[model samples]
Structure formats: C-alpha cells, structure tokens
Target: MTSDKAHNLWHQTCAEQIAAPVLSGDVTVDLVVIGGGYTGCSAALHAAQLGASVCLLEADEIGHGGSGRNVGLANAGLWLPPAEIRKHLGDGPGDRLVNLLSDAPRLVFDLIARHGIACEAVQNGTLHCAHSPSGLKDLQVRHTQLKTSGAPVMLLDADEAAARTGSAAFHGALFDPRAGTIQPLGYVRGLARAAMQAQALVHQHSPVLRLSHGAGMWQVETSAGSVRAKSLIQATNAYHRNLSSTAPEYVPVHYFQCATDPLPEELRATILPEGEGCWDTGLIMTSFRMDQMGRLIIGAMGDLDHLASSIHRAWVRRKLIELYPELQDVPLRQGWHGRIAMTSDHIPKITAIGPNAYAAHGYSGRGIGPGTVFGKGMAEALLSGNDISLPMPAIEAHHERMTGARQMFFETGATLTHLIKARF
Candidate 1:
C-alpha cells in the first residue's frame, strides 16, 4: 500500500513531499476528488489545467495506497487479451479501450518527462517470460492478437530470453519494448505535486467520513472540513473505505514485494543488466526488476503481513536462489504489501453513481497505466459533460460478488503454492 510509514524506499527518495493541509473549513469547487492515487491526482491535474476549480482529498498522503505499492510496470492493455475484451465488451468499446491502453506507457512516460518527475523512469521495455510450454503457448496466442492489431511486439526463443533475463528458467518470452517500470510511489507523488502546481487544491490526512449528494452539489465531510462541488470522483480503487453504499465494488487482491540490498559489484552485472523488468506466466505471477540503485526487487501475490507471510518469505528466498545462485547471501530486507481492485472481467470500470458523480476501480494488477489514462478520461468526460468521450462507456453499476471469499481463496492458493514450492 501507499504507506503510513516513511520507511518505504520510494518515500525515502521521493522528489515530492506532501505539503497540502487537511480540508479546512467549508469550500466549494467545480470538482471534488477523493483518494489521492493515480486516478485522483491525474483527474485533479487535468481538471485544474482545464481551468476548473478542483480540490482533491486523501485519507493519507498522496499515493499512500495501491498506487504507491504497485509493481510499476507501465504495461499496455488489461490482463485480458484483446479478443477476450471483445467478448466481454462489444467490438467498438473493446477496440477503443484496447487502443487507448496500448499507448498507456506513452502517456505515463510523457507525464514524467513533461513534469520533470524525479522518479527513476526506465523505458527499456518488459519481458513476459514463459513459465512452461503451456505458458509459451499462451504468449503465442497473445502475440498473434497483438500483432494482428499492429503492435510491434516480438517473441524470443529460450536462448534469447535467457540471454536477456540472465535466467535459464523459462521456455520463451514476449517482449514489449513499449512498456517499462518506475518508482511507483515517487511517480504518484510527483503527479500530485504537479496537480497542486496547476492550482488544484490537495489535502492529506483528510479522510472523508461521510459523502452525500444533495442541493445540486456533492458534499464530502471530514473532521477538518467539508467540501461541496458540482462533480465528485471516487478514485479509491482497492483502498476504498465505505464512503458510499452506492460505490462500485471489486475483489481485493494482495501483492507483496521484497528488495535485496544494493548488489555487490560482481552480482550487479549478472541479473537484468538490460534494465528490462520481467514477470512469468504462472498461475501465481512473479515479477523481477532492478531499481536505480541496483537492488533486485522481486514480487509475488500474497500479503506479507498476513498468516502466509512466513511461507511467502521462505519461498521468495528459495526462488531468488533458484533464479540466481550467485547472490545466495544477499538479504531481502524490505517487504511490503498492497491491495488490488480486481473486476470479474479483469477490465476497469467507470461507474456513474449519481448526477455528476463517478467512481473508477478494478484495474486488476494494471493500475499505473490504466489509472492514469482513466483519470484523464474521467476529467474530460465530467468537465465536458460528454460520457461518450470516455474510453469505456460509463455504466450505472458495476457488481462483483463474494469479494471476501474470493480474496481468501486467492490468498490460500498463493500460500499453498509457496509452501509447496519452497519445500520441493
């Protein structure tokens, strides 16, 4: 999660600090945004730039949620393949969303450069390594669909993938040169700072206790103050509090990461030297990347603070050793976990809750890119009163059943996998 603790690595080196105060006294604005993750910040930035009076409120510091804790791969598209997206959505909307997300990395990187965000932006690309032959087959299907849609993705054989990844543990890889990684927390904070600079008011430590719509304005009440605005956006995603019973619901998934201390000289040259981040095609995915300081950051799905913590940690140690025996002694000293909002279709949702009020959630694991893009779309749609301009049509409701049981089931499966893998 975007953390309450300043001990997080991204926070330590962050370029932007939270300078906004809590919502003080009553204020009126054109737009009021809740949850200071990617979407909220982006929306605030865009709306303010468009000359709208905007105020953004956060429960904690900006990006102190999944936006700060994500793997930071500015990937293209949703977890579902393009064909599957068409099956879920009709052709026009599906194709539009696919095309928009295809350029998500471009948008994210552009913002970084445009804003001079101090986050380490590595655009060398990412590798989807095949975990097995079946995984390779899945890549093949994905590759065909991507190629058919004019994407410049390339598939690498075992030898090529191994040479690039420095790990001979996969059948092949699908390489997307368009995508890359970032220090997520820093990036999100930078966005908030930029939004503030553009005249958007931001408040931290301003959790909204109650939200109501009445008298031609949406009102959010906080301990410090209340905000009344013509438009409101709920960008909380997975870290959502019970702000409204009518808010969209999604399955909450947990992902955790541990980073080794900066590698010694000899080891730094051996792993991911090409600067490409990677994730495998397993049932439970694993991601590996090198930070600007050469710390080998690896992550998997499971909360590090929960009952499965030990099993997950042990498995991480063994998995690192299995991937690269050269750094067996290096310690993974830092561990953190964050939540994900997962929709049933693995696609993001734009919900129209009431007049001039909207909520977006469920990017699954692809939040950075989608969240940024979705926020921009939300701003444009709300400001212009044009729902048809959105990438995906805004629906009245988005429903996901049994989120709690589903979350438990996913955690249990991850725990069992880690235990068996560590022992075997």
Candidate 2:
C-alpha cells in the first residue's frame, strides 16, 4: 500500500513534500541507488555532491517505506548496547562503530541545517525510559557503558524522570543529550530534494524490475527505463520489492503507531516538557514522542493490518490511559504500521552483492542516524573505490533462518503482550 493510504501522521503532517518524474529512457551514471529511503537518498545526495553522476529509483514516492513511518528518534548507536555490540563484533570494530554512531545525531542534524531541510528537527535529546525495576537495572548498565565510552548521558531518578516525562509510570531513565526527534517523512523527502538539487536524478514510482551485474557494470531495469552504473547501493531495508535474489535477508517485524489530536496547551505543558523522545525498556518496545503540532505519538511492536489489529488498537487506547490517566478519554486520530528488517544479531549488514554493488539493511528499528551515516559512507566508499571508509566490512552474503516463523513469533509475542500487559 502507498504511504498516503496508510493513515500515517507523518504523511499528513510532513512539511517537506517532493515529486520526481518516473524513470524513462536509458541513463548511465557513476552510481545507481535502488530505494529512495534515508540511505538511498543520502547516498545519491553525497555522491552527486562529490561530482559523481547518480540516479536513485524508487518504486513508490520518496520516504514511502520505513523512513516515512519511523518513530522519528534520531538516536545514537544501534539497538544493541555497547557491551552487547562488543560481544557480537569484537572490541576493535565494535568500538569503532559505537564511536561512529555516537556522533550520528550530529551528522543528521547538521545535514538538516546544511541542506535547509524543513524536517521538524529537534536536538533536545531522548530518554531511554525504564518500564520496570529490571529495566532500570538495564539502564544502569547502559549508563555505565556509555560513561566508559565518554558519552555525556544522565541517569534520571524516578522523580526526575516523572518530572521530565510528566508521567509517573517510569522507574528511571537514561538521558542521551545528543539525540533528538524530527519529522521523519519530511527528513527523507528533504534528503531527496537535496539530492536532486545536487544534480542527482531521482525517479519515483520507478520500481526496479530486474537487476543484473555484468561487464563490470550494474544494470537496473524498471518497467519503462533502465540505468547502467559503475556502482550500486540497494537501500530498500524492510520494504524491498521485486528483486528477491539481491534482497537482504532478515526477519520481518512490524511496528505500529497511534497519534492523538494536538493536545491542549495545559496538557502540552505537562507531557514531554523538554521535547525529548522516549522509548521504554520493554521487550515489545514502546516509543513516545511529540510533533511540532503538539500531537503525542505512541508506538509499539505489532502489526495493525493483521487479524490482531483490534487487540493492538485496544492496547494503544489502554496504554494511553495507563501512562497518563488524564488522557483516558482522548481519542486517537491516526494509526499506521510499518515493517522492520530485524537481523538475529541486531546488527546492520552491508553485503557485497556484486562486483561493485552493496546492499545495506537490518537496522532493527534504529534507522535515521545509522541510515544517514551508512548511506554517506557507502557513497564515499563506492566513489573512492575503497571499502576502508565503510562503518562495517561488507560481507559477501547474509542469510537468516526461519525468517517466516520468526516473524510470526514476534507478531504473536507482541499481540499477547499488548492483549494482557497494559490493561488499566
């Protein structure tokens, strides 16, 4: 389904709107990016700025995927904490990645300012809230690890967190002063606009029909036209279409969000007073943030388009009451869901799919900052003919076992949790 029909708050409220002509006729460029999400658009923009001819093709409009339907938290680092990342990727590479991503928010906000992106960029920071005592301990460990890495994070006590969040539901919170929120759809569309301004050819509604690499060049074909490029970057992430053989393998996890009408001034003064985005430390994670219009957006892990949609929606209503009893009667105005490409290890992958083509995916719900960083790094690496600049080494291929079953397990778990956990 197209983003317009999804009832997404981002689509309705996005300030940055753009349109590009569909791909027609043959075109050749130095780089051809498939997918017009954050990574693809950023790659095209940076490549074109560096004087490389670039063309980006998207099946739908720009930001039509997870980029448009994001939680809008431009957070640092991956879903995995620093210590777990070290356990997975070794100390050297893990530290490198952690350091790179710790500054990712700066990169995101800087790009927004530099390109004059109309995304509602906010850098007030974010709260990793504690849903329970155990969750508080988890934040303690994260706080220690972050401090060890020289990060400027503050651990807020329950009272402090309650004052900051305007809700007494949290046990504690780990505040990362570096992160923030944005209008996600606006940001991605702004990236596409900036890329176009930099002389990159971006085509919407141009779904890639076939992908083949031969004669040391990558050839991408759509319904009406084709592009042959010296290098390629596939940034389709969760909403991949048409090219299964080249698609990144991951378990598909669904996330849905519900937004209330812009809260009245008195209510707005209490919720998220500092405007920091928030997500609780629950297995079936829940996120909270506010838009420029003062609408409170709440999200959790569950598909709203499936048979269990009623349960999920019911849970959202109950959850709003559970968090803020004052909003017990506030009706939800918008609801939408999006897919996440979750890898088993919770690490993103950059796969060397062909001679000079790489496919990046598996953000696991941490999209904005990492997507921008990886996209620019991929563009630089492709242009310079050196992989040294990449955040992680490109693997030849990646595969996940029991993807379908795993996806179902996630959905089932979320459904069960929402069904029984948040009742007031």
Top candidate on TM-score is 2
Q: lDDT of all the models against the reference?
A: 0.88, 0.92
Model 1: residue 283 alpha-carbon error in angstroms: 0.7
Give the Å shift of residue 333 in candidate 2. 0.8
Instruction: Compose the digit string of candidate 2's lDDT tens values, residues 199-232.
Output: 9999999999999989989899999999999999
Candidate 2: RMSD to truth: 1.2
Write down the TM-score of every candidate: 0.97, 0.98
User: What TM-score would you give candidate 2 relative to the actual structure?
Assistant: 0.98
Clashing pairs in 2: none
Clashes of each: 2, 0
Q: Candidate 1 at residue 254, lDDT?
A: 90
CA RMSD, predictions in order = 1.6, 1.2
